[model samples]
Target: MRLTVNGSILLTELPLLERPAAVRAAGFDAIELWWPFASSTPDQADVDALVQALADAGVQLTGLNFNAGDMPGGDRGLVSWPERESDFLANLDVVTQIGERTGCRAFNALYGNRQPDADPVAQDSLGARNLAAAAAAVARIDGIVLVEPVSGMDAYPLKTAADTVAVIDRVASEHGATNLGLLLDVYHLAVNGDDVDAAIAAYRYRVAHVQIADAPGRDQPGTGDLPIERWLGDLASGGYAGWVGLEYKPAMPASQTDPFAWVPRERRTAH
Candidate 1:
């Protein structure tokens, strides 16, 4: 299992650009992030700084999200939003440059929430088109675009493996997009009351990336009753030889908690 620390969620104590070195110090050679900039298309210098930070830390960027507008403010994503098509497209270009510089091939596209005024069908259709475009962009670098079933946001539409995979299939059929796939996030699936085992068994091959956090509280493995180790074992046995992102919050402050005590020291590094 190649474990990539999710710098965006994990090292909240440090500045965004400094988390990669913290991740490396925590024994991971790889890290992932949500869009780290405030704007969808940030200045070239800002992009260059992030790339340089990763290089200095000696951590490979495994995955990154396309600009998913205001995540802290409850905006889940823009791919499915009707009014944000231009933002999504511009973000795709930035993602391509970041991927090219860092070798981060997997990109997670958070399916936006259902707008009260917009028809669900229309939102989904728009999302499919945007995702198809993203798939094509990343495909140039032998990369994949990931769609995940997120939790907590009631309006966020993709709530299960089936829901997300349906969109992937539609993109493939409608736009002939072969590079789009699923990002099977275990915590989100469990929170949404989906059968995690069944999801893995049913769509293991479609899984392009994986993320894990315990249920009840989005913390490390033992902080809750989730069978995280068991599920990871199943994924590996099922032939998911890809990155497993540690996308969890620490139970205590960064200075006080051994956030990664749950994972063995030797297994923390990328394989």
Candidate 2:
């Protein structure tokens, strides 16, 4: 399994370049970077430079994460609130460009807020409309546009595997795009009450990328009450082949612990 350090959730102290450097130093071959790309340095040149840094470090670009509109880390997706559609598209373009430049073929479009009073049918329609529009745009490019089932946010409060699959199917059908895929986040799955086994079996094909962190607190893998090894083995058995993103919070300092020791070091990909 390839592990992405989840540059934001784990490596907050380093620049985007150094995050991958740390990953390489820790013996990982591929790494994940987050949005707020400007945060690394408010210069596009710097973003490109970070791409080079990853290359120099021998760390492969696994994926690029887009920050949906929200209060820092809120679940405000593009489709639910039509007003921010412009901002949503704008951000997508920025990240899409970053992906192209950095050799990234996978991108995550997290599900956003759902209007409390909006009829379920109408909400689905609106979200589908927005996602299809965005997916079409992404399909024109070489990258894959993936949707994450987000919880605790108004937009994508999918607590069940069925609900999550419905969103994925609707987005794909509505967009008429086959590039749409799923980001199976184990943390969200546990909190949303999804059956890990069933979810693995059902979404094994569509699950383009996977992230693992403990639920309840979104901490490291062993820190939570999940059967991590079992589920991971099951997914692998289901013929799933993709990067296994290590998107968890570090219980200690980043310098202190090798967050990915749980991952077999020899199997880690180098590019």
Highest-TM-score candidate: 1
Question: How high is each candidate's TM-score?
Answer: 0.98, 0.86
Clashing pairs in 2: 77-112, 112-155, 113-154, 113-155, 114-154, 114-155
Over the stretch 1-271, how does candidate 1's per-residue lDDT look in tens digits? 8999998998888999999999889888999999999999999999999999999999999999999999989999999999988999989888998999999999999989888899998998899899999999998898899999999999998999999999999999999998988999999999999999999999988989999999889999878988988988998998998999999988789788788887888998866
Supply candidate 2's per-residue lDDT for 43: 72
| Model 1 lDDT at residue 222 | 79
Question: lDDT (CA) for every model shown?
Answer: 0.92, 0.71
> In model 2, where is the ten-residue run with the lowest total lDDT?
33-42
What TM-score does candidate 2 reach?
Answer: 0.86
